[model samples]
Target: MPTPGFPPHTLDDEGSPIWLDELAAEDPNHTLHVVRGLDPAAALEVLGAKPQWFQACELPDARPDEWTSLPGAALGAEPGSSATLLAGRVGEWTFVYDDFGATDHDSTEALSADGRAAATSMFSINADASLTYAVDGKQLAWINVDDLDLAEDLPGMPAELRAAFTAAGVVEFDYLEPGDPDYAIAMRAACALAGLACTLDDLRRIPLLVTPLG
Candidate 1:
């Protein structure tokens, strides 16, 4: 089984837990740049300094068959290398987006190996402040608090968050208790949405930010 924080046997290794905003704190002259949804110029605007170009930090290279089996097939670039706009992980499952605008290239495919395979779990914040869960780079579930009517459609949801939907008179489904399949995962999603700095295990160990009962 893959570990919770990092996968096993992937070519890339996990790095320290660094947030998106932390890149600016580091001296740009020394560290290589890793960005998401921003190009070098945009990154400079957001992070305040143009860091070095990115280079994939790969381990001893997985087999070709292993590379082809992942969700998004390693990586993807734009057609004719006009501009690179894609999302994937580098070493340590760090999410980064590289945009090479107006450059000519051969094909749209980027790297050969799935860099995201190293991530065992992750939470993404949607545009509307909703939350989604991804395990092993595959989306497991999502909860859109803005739309209460669509609660039943939420499959594999955790019990703690399900109450949020029910309280709003959205749906009345049996809730999963502590020992349920995705109970912990749901808790993490809820805490993340609430802007809590908690992990999968932290949900059980620490008090939630939103106070699900209140």
Candidate 2:
């Protein structure tokens, strides 16, 4: 039990935890036990002032635990071959941005209010196209407007873009033109070019009717 006079780690009025004190009270013996048999260099190296080597390896201070990424990262094996580039997330549940940029997608998007989605990371294609296919650890993807049949032929798309298609099927592209509806028609046309089945209804949902755009 903690001392009655002593207090729990401090919190700000906003309730942020004071982390410094918590570290001091933690069991160093337990820490050593967890890291035992592992290289001391590796353990101390992660938080140290100087670089170190282990087993002839000059390891980088790469934050493997963070949501790191490279721009233009794709969702599949082919990646940039045909697919457009976008932002990416590389943490536990990896996901790639399917060019979900706004101003080009025709509407200002705010994700569903229930907190199910975030607009900064979510988008639907314009009226005529669909993101049909993707590849990654998370496996999020979209079928083209014309490629919906290919979607069925190849594999399943993840839930995000699939949900978007139930409403619209245009992709977000970097080169969204300046004007009304942004780049919708052209973007949708590109998606339609793929010949994938994307929509059954103007609003593609509820027993999604998939006819091959091909």
Candidate 3:
């Protein structure tokens, strides 16, 4: 059995979803652990952090662990000034923002809530790996982890990764966009296939970036 942690193979020899493997290779410092069974507020407290460049905003209805912010005065006229970035908990997962200036400096508009979800690292990494094919919160079909072997014929799958899974006798799962009653089922199945304790319900509540505690 694979150990439940980082360094790729630590999780299992069956191997994690190919995308997850690549993600770990890119940023081994953070491990993606499932978040489950915690109160939303408590989860936020543990997960939320104030974003570095923005001035904080205090909303009347904001939860205790929530941090809402507009571009700070120092950002002055830069794209950050026009944006409102939020970092906090929504439902069961911790919502976080990556550095926008570092990656998306050309944009002229504020980040909308759906944009926030899309901009979040969780969605980005998954999309990059073809784990969940989505953009700006709109999910398209995803590679089925349970049906990887069949996925070799997928139109856009990365060939090297496809060969890797195929060589390993892995079966990739192919799923449609969420909204079908089976979306949750797919998430649950993926988690189990990946040796994760986190549930589909946890994922449905919010898309979150997983960070290693230590």
Candidate 4:
């Protein structure tokens, strides 16, 4: 069995953790971006947040309902705009979580500039999920977690990446049972590959800093 914080073992005989499933059920739509080599503050800045406007908050406090409930003026965002994120550092990587928001390709490329790397894992209410990895300012690979074939022919795909995909069971996503924790497993495995040891507990208890999405 792979270690708890590592791939394969992350989801054991019990399947995906209840918290992860509950989070997806509650939020339905969210995106998580992990940036290597940047602390939480610098990662938020790279994503276009002003230093003075930063808000210290927990991950739960940044949930869509909680955030949207606050007046736009309070968040320094346009009224009714769903453009906020909760970010924090886990080991050497900064994890940014956004509700109903996504970091575009340009932003990921920018975040990964100068020998750094970044990855985004997006989940939607419709059971759709995707992950993208970028390194040194270029998108290295992208894959729809539900469909591995979509990425089988990616040109210039690196061997290490393919290995990561394989180790994560992303390459065999099609074989998972209907109710398996495929999304969580694949996403966590990819994060592990980048040296991030994110767990459901981390997501729930981490001291996340908040800012409006850039």
Candidate 5:
């Protein structure tokens, strides 16, 4: 069976959607956030999206590559200044994606005000990647893939979360080489524990709410 995770690591894994691979290849500099218990609109607000500019769009239309042609693409003060965010609810979690790492660690606390929130970032241009989680308005854990030795679970972290981390072999992350698929495996496990399992098809078929960063 294909390994369970975002961006399936297996070769010719028919079980996984093609979009996952497409996303990993086409957008190397982006962030994917999953927040429990919040709908698309609520998640967007928590992530600091500008409400007035919000609209519903399909994944292709909202792709960051196409933002240059979006209605408000030129509204920013400078030339070629535009930001786009796409969010949708999948199962119990709201998934948000942006071209850059817009959701920082501090904002994650607010994203989990009612439940939990998990974010995974990949910025190949800067060779940066990180995973962050929060629960009940409190930041619990943050791990930069390049520095796994510095990761430590917080006091209030849920038992299931710890188990998920272990199952994903997070402790071995330090030894893995750059561009390893295990990094994504660990991220998928963490988000899965929070009830956030998303396939690329979900993004393509679902009507995600779109907005600009305020």
Candidate 6:
């Protein structure tokens, strides 16, 4: 089993969290950039997992094997040629992204507090928010005000936040990174949609995994 050991990713200049807005500014010709963060199963390809699959992150609706290669685009660019790899660690989880392949990309976006995955188990939340957690997927776990014991699988959050969650009835809460699976992701999507922008201090962000709930 993959151990949870990824770390918080940061930017070189401002020391802020690595984000998409920065990645999108890579080139002038590259007007559209699509990214998505895959789950453990999806990440196996990069972690020495064999037999690969490809797709254009921008065209999720497109055929699975099809990719619209754009000239001067990073994906189509030569290997190691100005290829920007953004990433971080959160235990055994290594979250990363390059504007290259489609499936390895973190394109699953948030309707609000917009987000995507840079790599496995590490999701990037563009906005601040709250979340709910449950051990049963078929059942719905409402956002409660109690603290949750999330040491086993939920290894990303800080000890302080975990304590808060335990007291607040929250079993899940992280600064939703860009790589987390969409299943049970972004609980307050509507909140992000209602308001154009909300500061990190204003709302609650949570990273909920449905697998454990199931």
Best by lDDT: 4
Query: Can you write out model 3's per-residue Cα lDDT over 111-202, one digit (the tens) per residue?
Result: 21234212112222243222332223344334533343342344454443233223333222345332222212222232332333332233
The local lDDT score (0 to 100) that residue 50 gets in candidate 6 is 37
Local error of candidate 3 at residue 111 (angstroms): 13
What's model 4's overall lDDT?
0.59
Per-candidate TM-scores read: 0.22, 0.18, 0.22, 0.67, 0.68, 0.23
lDDT of 2 by residue, 1-214 (tens): 1111112333212111222111111211001001112232322222221232212211122212222211112121132133222211212121112221222211111111122222211223223433322222121333343434423523353454444333223223355322212212222222222221122121112211111000
lDDT (Cα, tens digit) per residue for candidate 6, span 1-214: 0111112232212222223223333321111111133343343333332323232222111212222222113234443244233222233332333333322212222200123222111122222222332111111122221232244424554342233222322112254233332211222121111120222212113221111000
lDDT of 3: 0.28
C-alpha lDDT score of every prediction, in listed order: 0.25, 0.22, 0.28, 0.59, 0.54, 0.25
Which residue runs of candidate 3 sit more than 4 Å off their true CA positions? Answer: 1-9, 14-113, 116-131, 146-154, 157-214
lDDT of 5 at 212: 70
- Per-residue CA lDDT of model 5 for 72-92, tens digit only, reads 332321223444566777677
- Global CA lDDT of candidate 1, please? 0.25
Measured by TM-score, how close is model 3 to the native structure?
A: 0.22
**In the order shown, what is each candidate's alpha-carbon RMSD?**
18.2, 23.1, 15.9, 5.5, 5.7, 16.2
Candidate 4 residues lying further than 4 Å off, grouped into runs, are: 1-25, 59-81, 150-160, 170-181, 194-200, 203-206
Arranged by lDDT, best first: 4, 5, 3, 6, 1, 2
Sequence-dependent TM-score of model 1: 0.22
Off by over 4 Å in 6: 1-16, 25-50, 53-72, 77-91, 96-214
CA lDDT of 206 in candidate 2? 21
**Candidate with the larger TM-score of 1 and 4:** 4
Q: Per-residue lDDT of 114-160 in model 4, one digit per residue for the tens?
A: 99888777766686777788899999887776665424443345675
- Model 6 is weakest, by summed lDDT over 10 consecutive residues, at 205-214
Task: Point out where model 1 deviates above 4 Å.
Answer: 1-127, 149-195, 198-214
